[model samples]
Target: MLLELFTGKCPIDECFSGDVNLPKWVQSAFPENFMQVIDSKLLVGDVCNEDHDDGDGDDDDNLYVSPEIQVEYCLATVIEIGLSCTRDSPDGRITIRHALQKLKNAKHNFLKNRNGEKM
Candidate 1:
């Protein structure tokens, strides 16, 4: 729940719904402007509402992304996220830190569970 409220990644249904264990200082690192490109509507304005049967099939050209080109998209997004959050605003910095700590806690819990270690 906290992660969803903070990360703003994925759909609301896909968001993590659990209490975040990040400290106040760490939670303050992530920026409040965090955004995720879930739908292409933001990229191509009103494109979804356009007529597709106009025979241009060139509408396919507007849809540049191919499911088969997964590797390129995967790496690009990974790099993009890694380099994102420049902390241009104070909220940005806090959001980054909070999201980072939240992710760290999730990783820690996963490792402990896998190793049968107590946390």
Candidate 2:
């Protein structure tokens, strides 16, 4: 569920034929090409809503961490939880309660990071 939520891919996605399911597909892109595997929408950060530029076409010298990066960190944490839940052995997998707590932490951290950056 976490993998599907973050990566925007399903186990039965058409691209996942043969033995390649959502978890494997995401794993292949892990640790390096993760940005490619995740939902591109998450990175846009309001490119469609309005122009947030300060006319420099660059960083604009803002001190806050961009929302895009925060989402990426949150996504990475969620994906890790998904992978942990899908481990080959039941012993290796995290319990549902544990996963829930970790997810809550990830969300808390994401919100905290965003709030901290703004202040």
User: On a 0 to 1 TM-score scale, where does candidate 2 land against the true structure?
Assistant: 0.75
Deviation of model 1 at 24, angstroms: 26
Mind giving the per-residue lDDT tens digits that candidate 2 earns over 11-108? 78899988899889889988677878888766665523222444556684364556666777788888889999998899999999999999999988
Q: TM-scores of the models, in the given order?
A: 0.23, 0.75
TM-score of candidate 1 versus the correct structure, residues matched by position: 0.23
lDDT of 1 by residue, 8-113 (tens): 3433343324542222222344333123322223233321332223255554444333322222233233223433433346554446665566556655654453
The best candidate by lDDT is 2
Model 1: ten consecutive residues of lowest lDDT? 33-42
In model 1, what is the error at residue 29, expressed in angstroms?
A: 27
Model 2 misses residue 113 by how many Å? Answer: 1.1
Clashes of 2: 0
